[model samples]
Target: MAAKKSEYTCIKDNTIQNISRKTAELEARADYKDKRIDEINHNMEIMNNKLDQVLNSFNDLKLQSTSDDKELELRLKAIETKLAAQEKTTEDNKARSDRIIAIVSVILAALTFYFNYMH
Candidate 1:
């Protein structure tokens, strides 16, 4: 009976040591997992910052593009207005010159007929 008791005691001691070693290993794994999570979180924050910068740049470009388009439209309108005015002026000058030429031709014809009849 005494020998049996000693054997049982030895078995119990071995079980306790095994349980302690397993617990230590689990703690070490938990620590490693915690460090990995921290690293992932830090990397995510950097990525988020970069994304924000990219978005801001895009917004700035959009605003600049809109401004440039407006300026181009204004310039085009000015040019069109100038061209219209020039065309109108040219038409008016041509009409005035035609009337002057018709009057001169009539006067010349009258002078020629009078001189020929007098001679």
Candidate 2:
């Protein structure tokens, strides 16, 4: 009976030691997981900052494009107005010249007819 009792004590001691080693391994794994989570969080924050900068740049470009478009429109309208005025002036000049030419041609015709008849 005493021998059996000693054998049971030895088995109990071995089981306790195994349980302690497993517990330590679990704690180490938990520590490693915690470190990994921290790293992921820091990387995410960096990405967010970069994204914000990119968005701001895009917005600035959009505003600049709008301003440039407006300036171009105003310039185009001014040029069109000047072209219209120039066309009108050219038409007026052409009409005046045509009248002068017709009047001269009629007077020459009258002078030729008079000279022929008097001869």
What is the C-alpha local distance difference test score of each model?
A: 0.93, 0.93
Off by over 4 Å in 2: 1-10
lDDT string for model 1 (1-119, tens) is 45554333465887899999999999999999999999999999999999999999999999999999999999999999999999999999999999999999999888898898965
Per-residue alpha-carbon lDDT of candidate 2 for residues 1-119, written as tens digits (9 for 90 to 100): 46555343465887889999999999999999999999999999999999999999999999999999999999999999999999999999999999999999999988898899965
Off by over 4 Å in 1: 1-8, 104-119
> Which residue pairs in candidate 2 have backbone atoms (N, alpha carbon, C) closer than 3 angstroms, thus clashing?
none
Worst 10 residues of 2 by lDDT: 1-10
Residue 117's lDDT in candidate 2: 91
lDDT of 1 at 108: 88
Please give the TM-score that candidate 1 achieves against the real structure: 0.71
**lDDT accuracy of residue 29 in candidate 2:** 96
Alpha-carbon lDDT of model 2: 0.93
* TM-score, cand. 2: 0.77
